[model samples]
Target: MASRRRLFILLAILALVVGIDTLERPLANPDEGRYSEISREMAASGDWITPRLNGLKYFEKPPLQYWATAVSFSLFGENEYTARFYTAFCGLLTLFATWFTMRRLTNNETALLATGVLLSSPYFMALGVIVTLDMGLTCWLTVALAGFLYAQSDGTSEPTRRRAMGVAWAGMALAVLSKGLIGIVFPAAAIFLHCLLHRDWTLLKRLAWGRGIAIFLAIAAPWFVMVSRANPEFAHFFFVHEHFERFLTTQHRRVEPAWYFVPILFFGVLPWMFTLPSVAAASWLAERERRSFPWRRFALLWAGFIFLFFSASGSKLPAYLLPVFPMLALVIGDWLARTEPRRIALYLLPVVVVIVIGLAIGWGAPERAKSAWTRDLYGTARPFIVAGGLVISLGIAGAAWLLRKGERVVPLAIVVLATLVFVDCVEDGYEMLSPRQSGRDAAAVTRQWVDPSTRIYSVNYYDQTFPFYLKREVTLVNYVDEFALGQASEPRRSLPTVAAFVEDWKRPGSAVAIMQPGLLEEVLKPAGLAMILIHADERRVVVRKP
Candidate 1:
C-alpha cells in the first residue's frame, strides 16, 4: 500500500473506533464514577493541589487522570462524555501510534493487520470509553515504544538513534507521571530482555545517559514535586502502597489464576482474535538480522513481559494489562503481512463458537445485571441494543467469512471490532458498574423534603456511587467509611464504627440514615430510631429517623 492509501485506511479505522466507543453512557463503575466525581469536586473547589478521593487527600495513584478529567470538566461542564473525553482521545492516539510505528518497523501490510487487531480488541475499546488511567498510560507508553523502534529501524544512524532513544526515554517519563512507576518499569524490563535474547547491546548504549536523564526529570518531575509537596503523605503511599504493596499483597484480594489473561487476550481482542494466530506467526517469521527485524523479538517481549509481569503480581484486574496492547498489535501486524490465504479460513472456523458465546454473554449481561433502565436513558434508541447484539454476532461471522476468503476486509474487519468492543462491553456493561441507589435517585424521592442544607447520611452502607450522583457529602454511620473518607475528606473526617454509632445515636429526630436491612434491625431498633420510607434495595435500606 502506498503512503496515502495507508493514511486513508488509518483514518477510516480511527473513525470507526471513535464512533462505536461513543455509544457508552458514563456508567460510573465504582472507580471511574468515584474518580470523575472527585475530580469535578476538586475543580469546583479550586484545590488542584491536594488530590482528594471521596473527599480525603487520597495518596493513591498519581493525579493525572483526575487532572485530565478536571480539564475535560472545564470544556464540557462535567458529564459522562466529558469525563471520558481524555481517555477516548488517548485511546485513538494509542491505536494510530501503533499503526505508524508498526509500518516503520516492517511494512504497511503489517501495520494494517495490527490496526485491525487493535480496532477489534475488547479491553482497548472498552477502557477507551471510560474515565480511567489505563488509556493515558497506554498511549504515551506506546508512543515511547514507537519512538524506540524508529530509533532502531535499519537506516537510522547512531546520532539519530540516540535522539530517538532520548524521545523514547522522555516518553517513558511522561508515562510514569500519567500512571506511576509501572509506566517505565515494564518497558525497561522488556527492552532489557529483548537485548538479552538478541545479544544486541547497541541500542542500550545509544541513550545519552546524562542528557536523557535530565530530559526525563524535566518532563515528569514538576507534577510529582508540586503534588507531593502539597499533599505531604503522597510519596510513601504512592510509591510504597500503590506500587509495591499493590503488586505483592492480597490487600485488594483481586488475585486471579495464572491463565487470567488468557481469556482476556483471547476475547478482549475479539473478531481480530480469530486473526491473531496468523498475525503473531507472521511477526515471528519476519525476524532476520539483529537490527533488521524490528517487529520480531521486541514485539513479543513487550507483549509477554507486560502480560506475564502483571500476572506474576498479587493483585489483578482486566485493565492492568492495557500497556501490552500496542505490542500485541505490533506482533499481529507483522503476522498479517506474512499470512497465507489458505491459513485465513483456519482462523475463521472456530469463531462461529466464539461469537455464539459472546452473544449469550452479551445478551444476558443486561438482564442479569438489571441495567434495563439505561435503555430509557438512551430514549428511542433503546431497542437498538438488542439490534446491536445481533448486529455484532452477525457482523463477526460475516467478517470472519470475509477474512477466510482472503477478501481485502480492512474496512469490514474495522466495523466488527468496534461494535463488539463498544456495544457489548461499554454500552451494555455500564449497568453493572454502580448499583441503582436511592441516593442517586434522591432528587426524585427527596425533592420535596430536601433542603439545600438538609442533613444526609448513607448509614451502615457506603456506596461511593451514591454521593457522586447526589452531588453532596452524605455521612456514613458504622460502615466502611474508608472509601467514603477517601472521597470526601472535609467536615466529617472521622467516622464512628458500630460501637461508636451506638454511642452517638440520638433520637433528635432530625437525621436520615441509610443502612443495610439487617444492620437497621440491630442498630436502630434499640435506640427506638423512627423511620421514614426513603429507599430500599436488596443490598441497601434507607430510613429517615423521626
Candidate 2:
C-alpha cells in the first residue's frame, strides 16, 4: 500500500512538472516550429491523408506525430499547451512502460526506481514537453522493446508470450509509422544481435512471425501505400533520399564528430551516472548466477545498437540518443533498488561537484556574449540556474541525511524532486532564448499588419515558427530546404530566386516577406525597392512594399 501511494505521488509530481509552464514560452526554432506548424496545418486543413507544411506536401516525415498533435488541437483548441500535450503524454507513457517492464523483470521496488530514474533524467524530461516527433517515436520504441523483453522469458504462459509478441509487432508498426524504416530496423537488429549472442535460434520461431507480420502490415502499410499512390514522388524521396541518403551522405550538412554521442550518452543520463557503471557491472554478474534469459544482455544490445547506429550515421542530432535512455534507466533502477542508501549517497557526490562547476561557468557566461540581446538572455537565465542549483544542493544534502538515517525511499524522492526543479528551471529559462530564436513576437507584430488579402512571403530564409504563429501559410521565395521536392512538383507558389522575388514585388499589394536581416540590407536595400521595414529582429526581418 505504501509503495502504491509513493508511486502515485511520483506520478502526480511528474504530471505537474510536464504540464506546468508549457505555454510560458514560445516554441524554439527549426524542430519545434517546424513540427508545431505542420500539426497546425494538419488540423486546419482536415486533410489526414497528406501532411503539408507551409502549404506544401511535406513528405520528410510520416504523419503519426502530426496526427496526435492534430487530435490534441481538435480536443483542446490549438495553443502551445495543446500542441505540446501529446509529447508530454508520450513522456508519461515511456515512464509507465518502463515501470511495467521492470516489474515483469524484477519487482515493484525496482519498477518504481526505474520509473523515477527515467522521470529524473534531464534530457528525457526536457524532450517530453518540447514539440517534436522524437518523443512519440521513443515511446513506441519503448513499447516494442519492453514487449519483446517480456516475451523472451519462458516462465510466462503461452497466452502471455503470444500477447507480448503481438505487442512487439504492433509497436514496430507504430514505430515505422512514427519515423521510418528505422522503427523496424532498430528492433530487428537488436533482436538478431541478442539471438546471435545467446545462440538461441528457437527465439526466432517463438516470435509468432506469421501473425506478427500480418499485424505489422495492417497497421503500417495503408498510409505508406495511400500516400505513395497520391504522390508518385513520395516513395523515392522518403525512402531513398530521406532514409538512405541521409544515412550514407553528409549532404544534409548535419555532420558531427564520430564520437558525438559519447558525451550525449554520458551527460544525458545525469545524477544516475555515477552509480551506473558499478550498477551495470553488478547486475550483469548477478544475472549470470541464474539460468534465466539474458535480459540484461538484450538491453545492452538494444541501447548499444541505437548508439552505434546513430554514431555511424552521416547526420547526427542529440535527440537521436533518446531511445537508448529507457534501457539505461532500467539497468540503473534495478541496481538502485538493490543497493544500500548510504552507498548511493556516496555515489552522488560527483553529481554535486559537476553541478557546482556548471553553475560557476554559467555565472561567467553573460560577459562572454557580444550582443545586448545575448547578454540579457544569459542574465535572465542566471536566476533559474541559481534557483536550480540551490534546490539541488539542498536536496542532495537532505538525501544524504536521510540515507544516513536509513530512510531508503526518501533519498530517492529528494533526488527526483531536485531533478524536477532543474527541469522546471530549464523550461522557464527557455523564455530568455525566445526573442532571438522564436518567431512568436515577430509573428504577433506581423499579424497586426496582415489581413486575408495580404500575401506573406518567406524570402531566402524561412522561420519555421512563423506559419504556426500566424496560423497561415507563407509563400516560399527561393527558400525550400526539405521542401525542394514539394516545390519542384508545384512551382506556382514559390519564386525561384531573390531576383525573381524582386520582380514579383512590383506587382503586389500589402505583400510582406520574412527574410534574414543580412539579406534585407544587402540585396533589397541596395535595390532601392520601396520595401518598408515592418518587423525586425536579430535573426529575421519582416518587410512590406508601400
Candidate 3:
C-alpha cells in the first residue's frame, strides 16, 4: 500500500511538472506551429481523412496525431494547450506504461525507478512538452514494447498472453499511425534479430499472428485505405517518399553523420550516463543464464538496433531515437534496483562536473551571442539557465548526501524532483526565446489587420505559425520549400512570381505580405512596390499594401 502511495505521489508530481506550462508557452515554428495548424485546419474544415496544412494537402506522414489534436481542439477550443495536449498526454501515458510494464517484468521498486529515469531524461522529457509527432510515436512504441515484454514473460496464462499480444499489435498499429513504417519496422526487426541471435525460433510461433494481424489491420489499415482512395498520391508519397526515400536518401535535407546520435544519447540520458556502461555489461552477462525468454538481451538488441538504424538513415533528427530511451530506462532501472548506493553516488560525480561546466557556459551565453537581438534573448534566458543548474546541482548534492546515509529510494526521488525543476526552468528559458523562434507575437500584431477577406501573402519565406495564430491561411508568393509538393498540386493557391504577386497587390482591396527584412529591402523596395511597413522584427517584416 505504501509503495503504491509513493508511486501515485511520484506520478502526480511528474504530471504537474510536465503539464503546468503547456498553455503558457508560444508554439515554436516549423514543428509545433506546423503540426498545430494542421490539426486546427482539420478541426475547422471537418476533414479528418485528408490532412492539410495551410489549405494544402500534406501527405508527408500519417494523421493519427492530427486526429488526436483535432479532437483536443474540439474539446478544449483551439489554443496552445490544446495544440500540445496530445503530445503531452502521450508523454504521460508513456510514463505510466513504463511503470506498469516494468512492475510486471521486475518489481515495484524497479518500476518506480524506471519511471523516474524516463521522466528525468532531458531529451525525452523536453520533447514531451513540445508539439511533435515523435512523442506520440514514442508513446505507442513504448506501449508495444511493454506489451511484448509482458506477453513473453514467464508465469502468464494463455488468455493473458493473448491479451498482451493484442495490446502489442494495437500499439504497433497506433505507432504506425503516429509516424510511418518505422513503427512496424523497428519492432519487427528487433524481434527477428533477437530470435536469430538466440537461435530461438519458437517465440515466433507464439506471437499469435492470426489475431494479432487482425488487430493491427483493424487499427492501422482504415486511414491508409480511406486516404489512399481519396487521394491516389498518398500511398506513393507516404510509403515511398516518406518512408523509403526519407530513410535511404537525404531528400529531406536532414543529413547527418553516422555518429550523430552518440552525443545525443550521451547527453540525453543525463544523470544516468555514467551507469550505462555497467548496466549494459550487466544486461549482456545476465543473458547467458536466461530462462524461458532472454528479455534482457531482447531489450539490449532493441536499443542497439534502433540506435544503429537511425544512425545509418539518410535523414536523422535528435527526436528520432526517442523509442530507445524506454528500454534503456528499464535496464538502468533494474541495475539501480540491485546496485549499491555507494556505486550510484560515484556515478553521479561526473554529472556534477557536467552541470558546473553547463553553468559556466550559461553564464557566458549572452556574451557569445552574434547579434544584439540574440544577445537580448540570451540575456533573458541566462537567469533561468543559472536557476536550472543550481536546482539540479542542489539535487545532486542532496542525493549524494542521502546515498552516504544509505538511503536508496529517497535519493532517486530527490534527483527526479531536481531534474524536473531543471527541465521546467529550461522550458521557461526556451519560452523566452519564442519571440525570435515563433511568429506568435508577430501574428498577434498582424491579427488586428487581418479578417476573413484580407489576402495575406507570404513572400520569399513562410512563417509556419502565422496561419494558426491568424486563424487563416496565407498565399505563398515566389516561395516553395516544404510546400513544394503542395504548390505543384495546387498551383492556383500560390503566386508563382513577384510580378504576379505585384499584380495581385495592385488589384487587392486590403492585403498584407510577410517576408524577411532582406527581401523587403533588397527585392520589394528595389522593385518599387509601394508598401507600408506595419511590423518588423529581426527575422521578418509584415508589410501592408498602401
Candidate 4:
C-alpha cells in the first residue's frame, strides 16, 4: 500500500512538472520553429511520405516526428501545445520505461530512485517539454534497450521473451523512423560490445535474429523505400550527405572541439552529477565481481559508446547526448538506493554549499555581464535563479537532515521535489531570452500587414518560426543554408542574388520581405528600390513596396 501510494505521488509530480505551460511558451527559433512548421505543412498538405519545409522537399531528417506532430494537429487542432504534445508524451513514456527496466535488474527502491533521477533532471525535464525529435528518438531507444534487457533475463518465460524481443525490434524500427541510422546503430553497437566483452556465443543465439530482422524491416524499411521511390535525389541526400558526410566532415558548419560533450554530460545531469564518479566506480566494481552481463554494465556501455560516438563525429548538438541520460539515471539511482544514509548526507553538504555560492553568483551576475542584452536578461532572470537555488539548497538540507535521522525514501522524495522546482525555475527564467530568440511576435505582426496572397520573401535571412505563425510560405531571396537541396529541386522559386531580388521587386505587385536590419542600408538603398518599412525588430526587419 505504501509503495503504491508513493508511486501515485511520483506520477502526479511528473504530470504536473512536465505538462504545465507546455502550450503557453512560444516556439523558439531554428529547432522548435523549424520542426513545428514542418509538421504544420505535413498536416495541412496531407502528404505524410515526403517532408516539405515551405513546400519544398526537406530530406535532412526522417518523417517520424513530422508524422507524430501531424497526427497531433489532426486530433488537437494545430497549436503550440499540440505541436509539442508528442515530445512530452514520449518523455513520460521514457520515465516509466526506465523504472520498469531498472526494477527488472534491481529492486523497487532502486527503480523508484532511477525514475526520479530521470524525471527531475533539469536537462531531461527541459527536453521533455521542448518540441524536438530528440525526445522521441530517446524514448524509442529507451524502449529498445529496456526490451532487450528484459529479453536477455535468464528466468523469464518463453512467451515473455518472445514479446520482449518483438518490442526490441519494433523499437529499432520506430527509432530509425524517428532520427536515422544512429537509432539502430546505437543499440546494435551496445549489444555487440556486450557480447564481445562477455565472449558469449550462446547470447547471440538468444537474439532470435531471424524474426528480429523481419520486424525491423517491416516497420522501418517501407518509409525509406517509398520516399526514395518518390524522390530519386533522396537516396544520396539522406544516406550520403546527411549521415556519412555529417558525421565525417564539418561541412554542415556545426563543428565543435572534440571534448564538447564532456561539459555537456556533466551539466546535463546536474544535482546528481557530482555523485556519478563514486557511484559509477562502485557499480562497475560490483558488475565485474558478478562475472555476468548485468543491466548496470549494459547501461554504462550504452551511455559510454553513444557519448564517444557523437564526440568523435564532426557535427555536434547538446541534445544529441540525450541517449546517455537514461543509463546515467540508472547508475545514479542504483547508487542512491544502496548507499548508506550517513554517506548520502555527507555527499549533499558540499552540494548545498556549491548551490548557495551559485545562487550568490547568479544574483550578482547581471552586473558583470559584458553584453547589455545579457545583463538585462540575467537581471530579469535573477529572481527565478535565486528561487530555484533556494529550493534546491533547502531541499538538499532537508534531505540531508532526514538521511542523518535514518529516514531513507523520504529524503529522495524531498530531493525529487527540489529538482522539479529547480528545473521549473530554469524554464520559467528562460522567457527572458525568448524575445530575441523567438519570431512569433514578429510573425504575428507580419500577418497583420501581409496576407497569404502577398509575395513574401526572406531576404538573405530566415526566421524559421515566422512561416508557421504567418501560415504561409516565404520565398528565399539570395539565401540557402540547409535548404540548398530543396532549392536545387526548384531553382525557379528562389532569387539567387540581391540584384535578382531587386529586379523582381521592381516588377512585383504588393510584396513584403523580411531580412536582417543592416541589409536595408547596405543592399536596398544602394540598389535604389523604393521600400516601406512595415515592421522592425532587433533580429529582423520587414519591408514592403510602396
Per-structure clash totals for the candidates: 13, 0, 0, 0
What residue runs in model 3 are displaced by over 4 Å at the alpha carbon?
1-4, 7-11
lDDT of 3 by residue, 188-220 (tens): 999999889888888898787999999999999
Give lDDT per model, in order: 0.67, 0.84, 0.87, 0.84
TM-score of each: 0.86, 0.96, 0.98, 0.96
The root-mean-square deviation over C-alpha atoms between each candidate and the true structure, in angstroms, is 4.2, 1.7, 1.3, 1.9
Error of 1 at 88 (Å): 0.8
lDDT by residue for model 4 over 161-215, one digit each (tens)?
A: 8789889988888999999998899998988888888776677777768888999
Candidate 1 residues 159-241, lDDT tens each? 88788878888889878878899878877887788778778787577667787788888988888898778766668778888
Candidate with the greatest TM-score versus the true structure = 3
Over 4 Å off, model 2: 1-4, 7-11
Can you list the residue pairs that collide in candidate 2?
none
Displacement of the residue 331 alpha carbon in candidate 4, Å: 1.9
Which candidate would rank higher by lDDT, 3 or 4? 3
How much does candidate 1 score in TM-score? 0.86
Query: Which residue pairs collide, candidate 4?
Result: none
C-alpha positional error of residue 343 in candidate 4 after TM-score superposition, expressed in Å: 1.1
Q: What is the lDDT of candidate 4?
A: 0.84
